[model samples]
Target: MELNYEGFYRFVRDELNVDLNAYKEKQLKRRIATVMKSSGALTLEDYSELIASDEVIRNKFLDYITINVTEFYRNKDIFTDFEFILRDYLNRQFKNIKIWSAACSIGAEPYSLAMILDKNNIKTNEKIIATDIDDNILKKAKDGVFKDFEIKNLDKKDLDKYFIEKENKYYIKDNIKGMVSFKKHDLVLDKYQKGFHAIICRNVIIYLKSETKDEIYKKFNESLVKGGILFTGATEAIYNPKEFGFKKISTFIYEKI
Candidate 1:
């Protein structure tokens, strides 16, 4: 049989439970092609067979597709804005806040939020739920050790307060680490947990198709309480926030209405 992209997509869904249809087709295809080239498979069928039998190849494919590029306080200006919003908007309404860091690669975003909460003195009994699709990334997040480059945006005071530096690596302090709970979650397939005071799903939905992004936004709106916040990536702003029952609160911040 000829190399079939559709068949390959189905095979991946069956084997990995990841729906490629949600991802932008052109970008997904380009990534798949790169994997195929690296694996020396000229045909999609050959690559699919290789992935089916080889654990290493399968994991590589999963990792590549997930796009795990993250850093502590990524897009520093936006996070600065978020800290203010958290203190002024969220803290005032919710006494014990529940936050979800969806597609939270390596835990930087949630940990950053935890630090902000700590700094602002927002006493919350509930821990932040930090989740990602990749199991390996979740493990790394649990470890909470980061290189200097990963935390470049953090100030010296915040660094000294929340991290212990040994050699060149920075380990998150027990207090900060304890405030976050990491888990493996696929945003496309998994049902969203509700009643969140805020949800930070940044730099992720840009890779998905418009319809899929819309569906996820709607789900996020449903997942949050009325007047809850949805903090998106700097580049992933919702053009029509009202469509998803959200009103634009700031540059990348949306409030559930």
Candidate 2:
């Protein structure tokens, strides 16, 4: 039998609680097919059974579909510019900043933000919220353990200051680890929390459908306080910021106006 993507989507929605419909159909289908094939499943229905029955297969399926490729200080130049904006602009504007690192894979992005905050001594009312749809990734994030490749972007100074090297792995220091709190959040379906001084959601939204992306941008705008910043990935710039109550302040950065 041919792949039953409609049935698979429903199965994923009802069982996995992930809305596959929100993602670009063609890209998602291609990714699904690739992962499905790796499981030696002839059909999507069989693949779904394997995913449901085997925890390893289930984790693999979720990890693959979510596309969680990330590292500390991803795109060094962009992060450097963002750090400057955080210290010079957002810090000056807000007394106690609230940041949300959406789609944070394995906690690197939020941890990077925490490092920036700690280095600058920026005070926050609460811990920085780092969220992802994948619970398995969230658990790894909470553990704060990383491989060398995952932290290759960090300079020696930051590495020495922020992490403790044990054997072949690096563990995030308690001080920095305390700065961020991890949670499970689905951007496509969950209600966004409001009054954030800055919302950093990068890379993930590019895979979503246009209408879904627009809706998410709207939600992100509403979630931020007036004059807050919304940071996007290098390739995910909003063509028209005004449509989302944003003003293009810099490359890949938007100010909620």
lDDT of 1 by residue, 146-177 (tens): 99889999999999999999999999999999
- Candidate 1 backbone collisions, by pair: none
TM-score, predicted candidate 1 vs. hidden true structure? 0.97
Give candidate 2's whole-model lDDT: 0.94
RMSD of 1: 1.1
Q: Give the TM-score of candidate 2.
A: 0.97
Ten contiguous residues minimizing lDDT sum, candidate 2: 1-10
Per-residue accuracy of model 2 over 1-257 as CA lDDT, tens digit each: 54478888999999899999999999998999898899999888788889889999999999999969899988889888899999999999999999999999999999999999999989899999999999899999999999999999999999999999999999999999999989999999899999999999999999999999999999999999999999999889999999999999888989999
Off by over 4 Å in 1: none
Runs with alpha carbons beyond 4 Å of true place in candidate 2: 1-3
Q: Candidate 2, residue 235: CA error in Å?
A: 0.8
For model 1, give the 10-residue run with minimal summed lDDT: 1-10
